[model samples]
Target: ACTVARQKSDLFHKYALRNAANLLKPEAYLKPLEQKIKNVSSILKNKEETVLNAWHYRKKIIDEYLQYISFKRNTDKVFVWIDEHDECFVSKLEELDINDEGYMDFVRALK
Candidate 1:
């Protein structure tokens, strides 16, 4: 989804650049702007991958935590609590420290 959004933004940016260039000079070349667009697109692509990876990692931790909690108490009640406060739960999960593991470090690295 992030990638798609970036692509849409890039499409708009490309046309905007072309229009401005045309207005300034009929023969104006857009090679420089094209290169910049490519650079920004590459950056967005890398960031999107990093974000998706972080979400996957967070999901792994949340699943493990849910399993642990479910075993200790009522599964339905635990699920309801998780569903009710999903944002809070995910935020806590993102900051959670797992033993000596640097899970929060990974979350912090997500751009």
Candidate 2:
């Protein structure tokens, strides 16, 4: 689980950075951001069950990115995705038992 979490986290970070960089480019030169966001979102959705914290972190990154973009553009599409994913991540976090030995070990290893 930890190994999978690490790998997913790495991929999320990579795409998040790439997306941010692309966003900074002039509009004419920018790459499509939707694909990068989708990639990270898919990773989070697929791995959330096994690594909650890692999923949380990656989801948070994508949420922030969406929020940032939404603020810059007049679009409702991004909000829809944010609302849907927010429910899933929140429910998962609520289900977590912080005192569990395995969970603590996973958190420690992440540190």
Candidate 3:
């Protein structure tokens, strides 16, 4: 589970940071990536103690995604995306059962 989560996070970073500029609609990539992270985090949640690295990796992915959006000068899209999926994102964060600074900072930033 940990390995899979790391790989998925890595792939998300690759696309989000490296290939994002090439895409005409970068926000189009956000939903799927979000879903993938949610799924991986869910799996890692069950093994929380043993998979601490995976949770940290998940945090890194979120940080990188935020950085990517800022780099593209599309900060507004972040709010739009959150608004569109606010409940889902918040609920997933709650379910993860991890005290991830990135996740907390994200929620705080949204406020």
Q: Against the true structure, whose TM-score is highest?
A: 1
Over 4 Å off in model 3, which ranges?
Answer: 1-4, 7-11, 48-111
| Arranged by lDDT, best first | 1, 3, 2
Estimated TM-score for each candidate: 0.50, 0.23, 0.31
Per-residue alpha-carbon lDDT of candidate 3 for residues 23-81, written as tens digits (9 for 90 to 100): 88877876687677767766665665556767788999999999997877776877688
Model 1, range 88-110, lDDT digits (tens) per residue? 75577766645444765654443
lDDT of 1: 0.74
Each prediction's total of clashing residue pairs, residues at least 3 apart in sequence or on different chains, is 0, 0, 0
> What TM-score does candidate 3 get on C-alpha atoms?
0.31
RMSD of model 3, in Å? 29.5
Pairs with steric clashes in candidate 2 = none
Stronger candidate by lDDT (2 vs 3) = 3
* Native-to-model Cα distance after best TM-score fit, residue 8 in candidate 3, in Å: 5.4
Those runs of model 1 whose alpha carbons end farther than 4 Å from true positions after fitting are 1-5, 17-28, 74-111
